[model samples]
Target: MEVLLSLVVGALVAAAIYLMLSRDLLRFLFGLILISNAANLSIFVSGRLISGAPPLIEKGQDFPVGEVANALPQALVLTAIVIGFGLFAFALVLTLRAYRSLGTLDTDEMRVAEPKDPS
Candidate 1:
């Protein structure tokens, strides 16, 4: 099961990397989302590989040690997810504006709009 998870995580990371290299803005955005998810999965898998464990401390238990998955990685992943969401939203808006202004999604054709000067 752990091996399967690792394989799936590796594939997702690979696909995310491939998507990130594409030239399309939308593809790039999607790549970022994929990358973020892959990272979260990686973090989750790295810590003890617990299955269906709660992250809460039990009552009257010393040190609160249990078969719980590491909460640190989960917290980190949550933070990363939030940050990634903000970045994705900002990128989406930027892409939309660029599309509206340039009338195209091609990066090659979306060069900076410069003003014409006449002497």
Candidate 2:
């Protein structure tokens, strides 16, 4: 299972890098999302995969009697997801505003600081 997950994460990272190198702003944003998800998945896999057990201890016992899943990675992933959503939303809004103002989504064409055809 870990091997499969590692392969999936590798694929996601590769795709994200490929998309990130594109000249389109939208593709870059998608790549950013993919990379973030890949990171979260990597973290999750690092925590190990235990089945049929929650990350909780019995009230009477100080420690769990059976194998339990790690909670830190889960919490970290949850936090990362919330933060990623907010960042993605802000980036999307910024991109939309740039598109509205510049009328282009291409990074090269959206260079307002450098005019292509000078007047």
Candidate 3:
């Protein structure tokens, strides 16, 4: 299970890179989202895979009776998910504004600030 998850994360990162290399602003935005999700997945996989166990102790026990899944990664991923969503929303709005102003989503063409065309 862990191996499969690792492969999935790797694939996601690769796809994110490919998308990020595109010339379109929307593609870059999607790439950023994919990479963020990949990072979250990697962090989650680092916590190890355990089944049917909760990280809790009995009333008289100092530790859990059985091996339990780590909760830190879960919490971290949850937090990252929220943050990623916010970032995505902000980026999406920024992209929309840029498109409205510049009339294009191509990064190479959004060069109004450049004094001279490099071509």
TM-score of each: 0.79, 0.90, 0.92
User: Stretches of candidate 1 above 4 Å error?
Assistant: 52-62, 113-119
Best by lDDT: 3
Candidate 3 vs. truth: CA RMSD? Answer: 1.5
Q: What would the TM-score be for candidate 3 when compared with the true structure?
A: 0.92
RMSD of each: 3.6, 2.0, 1.5
Q: Which of the two candidates, 2 or 3, achieves a greater TM-score against the reference?
A: 3
1-119, model 3: which lDDT tens digit per residue? Answer: 99999999999999999999999999999999999999999999999888848889999999888778898999999999999999999999999999999999999899898888568
Q: What lDDT does each candidate get?
A: 0.82, 0.94, 0.95
lDDT of 1: 0.82
User: How are the candidates ranked when ordered by lDDT, highest leading?
Assistant: 3, 2, 1
Residue 47 alpha-carbon offset, candidate 2, angstroms: 0.4
TM-score, prediction 1:
0.79
Residue-by-residue lDDT tens digits, candidate 1, 44-111: 77775667477676788665575676778778888989998998999999999999988887776766
Candidate number with the higher TM-score (1 or 3): 3
lDDT of 3: 0.95
